[model samples]
Target: MMEPAVCGEPTEPAAPPPLLAQLRAWLAAWLTDERTARELVDYGRVGHYTLALTRWVAIIGQLFTVLFVHFSIGIALPLVPLLAAIAASALVNLVLLWVLGWRARLSERAAAGMFVFDLAQLALLLGLTGGIQNPFVVLLLVPVGIAAGLLGRTFTATVTALGLLVASLLAADPLPLPWFTGGLVFPELYRFAAWAALSTAILLIAVYTYQFAEEARHRAEALAATRLALAREQELAALGGQAAAAAHMLGSPLGTIAVVAKELVNALPADHPLREEANEILDQVHRCREILKTLGPRRAGSEVDRLVRAPLSATLRDIADEFGRAGISTEVRVDSPDGTPEPCLALPPDIRHAIANLVDNAIQFATSRVDILVSSSHERLLVAIRDDGPGFSPDILDWIGEPYLSTRHDRGGLGLGIFIANTLLARTGGKLHFGNTGRGAEVRIEWPAGALERAVEEREHDGGHD
Candidate 1:
């Protein structure tokens, strides 16, 4: 049975939920409810409002071309009822902009609504100006293209479909063009423009959304890395506090036990077997007191950098011991090829957590045995974990450590274990490699000894300032 816990062993807490999961949940919520849609956009960016301003300019430019400039261009223009309708709609849009104000950012819903209104206004312009016969009808796609870049897929898709429907409807019935005397006809070219407008909306929306979403994903990944690093630092900070508290609280009980054991030794007869047991108890209590005394001041320090650093061998042993307590068949060994003494290494929370995660993964997949081997020289330090079980499948080998990509889904693997491990180790100047030993699976971690030492020092220096 696993014991409650032993003092001095570093505990690896569960990783925070993957950010990808949070993103997926938000996307689902936004797609279902208009209220939920308002939070998905980063309206703080100036570009969000710029798109709307550009739409206004385009609408105003189109109105000027039909109402005033057509006569100069020798296009036989005449103002119709559609011109009045377009002017009134444009006026409403201008008033809406004035109410929204330039300083305030539009919510996601309002932004989407703005694009929808642009589509409606453009559709009306197309019907009046000659429907598909007007070359500028292709401009109806502008709203959907903007939606693709600034809004979620559901909203973009809605706009794209609406644009397509408007194109189709315009092909069937369009009011007479004011520029034409009797109603000019260009059958073949108009038919082509209708098909072109529909196709262009779909294609441009796909291209723009894909480009923008990919950029957003990259930013999210960078933010996630910074978050993971901060979490490791906080966990270490918490551990130091807990360790000091444990030592402080246990000091008195251990003193009383030492006193009791000494008295018992004095009371027992010299020949009695119980005397030796009492003496052993006194010795143990004395050892415990010495340990507490040493731990007291180090643990008392407020900074994580001041916590006691262990040799690599001890760190591995602590991890193995914790797993061994859980009834897993685990062995830890330090191999010195040059027969030199192993270097004492600082066990920062990030390194400890990474190693422990790999060990846990090995235990889960192993049939019987898992071995953690540490070997180092003047140049390099290496830790290799091997397990006797089926190795990673070929399909997932290249994609290992990617979030949400797991082989053991049935066993509740979220596939984030390897990713967290790999990320943390990378920060410490370590490289993680995975492969099969023909018999099972193996993961090897290596670091240049000098680079790792410097990384540890830099981390301490930075953390101390924090």
Candidate 2:
């Protein structure tokens, strides 16, 4: 039928399907958001065994609940459809197990797909049994929670949206609740309340679980980085020891060769052809000795002390000089109790590396000058590094030695230097204090006076026994 247009009357446009509109928006957002794309691409995988075990538990529980309610309690449930849904889930699980094996790890997309399936299956079962009116409707939140903990943010959000959508649909026109007397009826307001409660719980639980799991993952990664740094320092120290041993072993033979060459040069006539060759041999032998000496002390008596130990003042001065040459005016000062010689410490590679890292950090932030102060007494040794520049940010000062805690984003550093230095210092019984001085940032490292020497001695003793 056709009607003539009226001048004062207007007709409304037809609205798009809600589901199609939502799907379009979701797709557009996923395609446009770079962070979400990266997360989905790089998210870690979940093991097959873990997924299978959880699914089996859920399936068994569902079967048991349906059987008990329909048979034992005599509730007139749609047993065939309920069992069919459960069997569908079980069949999918079996197919996955058979194809992928129990040891397989599901990729990010694969895991997300599996979770979506589980959510849909659970929603379907709820739709048949009475939707939000059924007590088992609470189980719908489980998959979303697990996804939030194991999957990326976008995936979690997607799962949550699906759960909300299903809950809303169930609220609209769910099948009657199974009961001994025909069917149990719930008020419309009560059903709405249940839907609202379930939706709120899903969001809250997902957020909490995601945050907790993310924190644990970050801590684990930081610890792994720390261990790698420490291991590298240990490897360098081991290499140094090997070089010292080689130098010690080679010194005697080189000395013997030098003596023989010198004697031959003296015994041969200057005009003899052998005389120049002998002199060349002696010169080469001298060069070899000099090279070995640079590696370590040639004499066994002083090898350990000369190669492994250095005065604390000298170490600080060396670190200061290194940074001083890099455009920063670095100064070092040493103080001790009256008439006491400066303490010499076993300069293990880790300790040296830690000290160097601190000095380098100071230089990086210093506007023009850096000051290094060393003080020693009978009981303790202390080192303080200060710089004239903008001090540490007050917000992060309390969390100073934690991994990846950095304020200098412009430098493209991961902020592991301080954490590595702090960790190594702690291992050697040193305590670090961080604060802001009047002009800039200040870091103080303190250790027992003899701790360095004792640690070295223990290591050497252990090595000998091994």
Candidate 3:
């Protein structure tokens, strides 16, 4: 016997590399793309939040500074200058909050301005205190850290560099640490360590936040695409019963018209001019009757209960024609066992939508041509879609048909197209298989004879309650 076709044959795409290797590759790609490296988050309300947080921090910091000065512990900080800086920052933040209340979103420039002002206040506070030797000096980076996570690289880098500059300057003449008695002195090594720690923290936090934010955005978009596809499938399924009812109702009225025309032809005199018109009406009635006969009886089989109960081959052709209109070349072929009737494949709306999605995907990926094959044998039905283009990438080959696993992100693909298609087909007792030819991608869908028709009927029956 001939062997069954394995998914990744010699002609197929190669397997993906190790997970660590793949991670490194994606990380490199993301870092090189400035937009991707920048955090993707809505900063609409962040300004208001930042201003509020700063106001509270300033108020508390001022209160502490006043109490420390009264005790005259550490080298007495210039208490008046420190209090003035805190008051200035508080006034600025209050004004910002009032302005933001009427605005929907903060402009990047405006947000950056506020952060710069905060950084300036932090530097002044450090200058009055113990500079880098003061434990609170680390707080100088707070505004810059927030900016790095929400702004572009140019802005983030600028803020970070500015913060480091201020810290370096303050390190030269910072007052001694506060104490109940004499001020404490810091060693040179501790000063260097503090500077290094702050710099490292800023860079690492920016990169980590950017990577995670990008991932979250991508996932949300993919889920949305999946929901859209499933919703369209449900809509098509809902129309199935209505289509069947219309076809069934028209059959009886057409038959009555045919009977009336035939009676008129017999009653008219052969020599009368009206006789020929009656004959024409009778002839047209016969044509309609012949068409209605194919629709079958309303109560015959579960397959006939849907409006979209066309043979599988016809449905495929229609889908192909739709793509042909879009300028894509499509070829459709069908193979059936000898003595097997045509129109053997039954398609409800859901199945039809699923097939269309598969066809659309093939056309999109194909370089110049797409081939659709329908066949039946030994009580089984099958459909195969082939495209003449570069096949699936090795990294994503095994992940095909999985949600959020798209290789066409640049094309606005959410990676849910194949997943949605597979899910819809599964509901109708069909299985979707993916593979790669040396030249391109291939998909195969299979079902047992009469299986899909029954599944569709059951789905419709269940849907009636809600």
Pick by TM-score: which candidate is best?
2
Give the per-residue lDDT digits (tens) of candidate 1, residues 1-466: 7556678987768677788666645543443344545533452243334855786687678778775646666565546655775676667566554444444455567667767877888787677777777777768767777677776666667777887778877777665554536566567666766667567766776567756674575456645765876687788777756765788899889989988999999899999989999999999988887776554434223343334666677888788667653445888889878775565657667778778888878888888888888888777888899988898887778878776567799999866677878888898889988888987899999988666667776665554341
lDDT of each: 0.71, 0.80, 0.69
> Candidate 2, overall lDDT?
0.80
Candidate 2 lDDT over residue span 422-441, tens digit each = 88888778999998998999
lDDT: worst 10-residue window of model 1: 297-306
Evaluated at residue 46, the lDDT of candidate 2 is 56
> Top lDDT: which candidate number?
2
* Candidate 1 TM-score over all chains jointly: 0.58
Tell me each candidate's TM-score: 0.58, 0.70, 0.61
After superposing candidate 3 on the true structure, give the runs of residues whose Cα lies further than 4 Å from its correct spot: 1-75, 107-117, 137-185, 228-307, 310-314, 325-328, 332-355, 372-384, 395-406, 409-436, 442-454, 463-466
Alpha-carbon runs more than 4 Å astray in model 2: 1-45, 60-64, 71-73, 79-104, 152-175, 187-204, 244-259, 262-273, 276-280, 286-346, 362-371, 375-379, 387-395, 404-415, 438-440, 450-466
Q: With candidate 1 superimposed using the best TM-score fit, by how many Å does residue 190's alpha carbon deviate from the native?
A: 6.8
lDDT score for candidate 1 against the true structure:
0.71
User: Where's the lowest-lDDT run of ten residues in candidate 3?
Assistant: 36-45
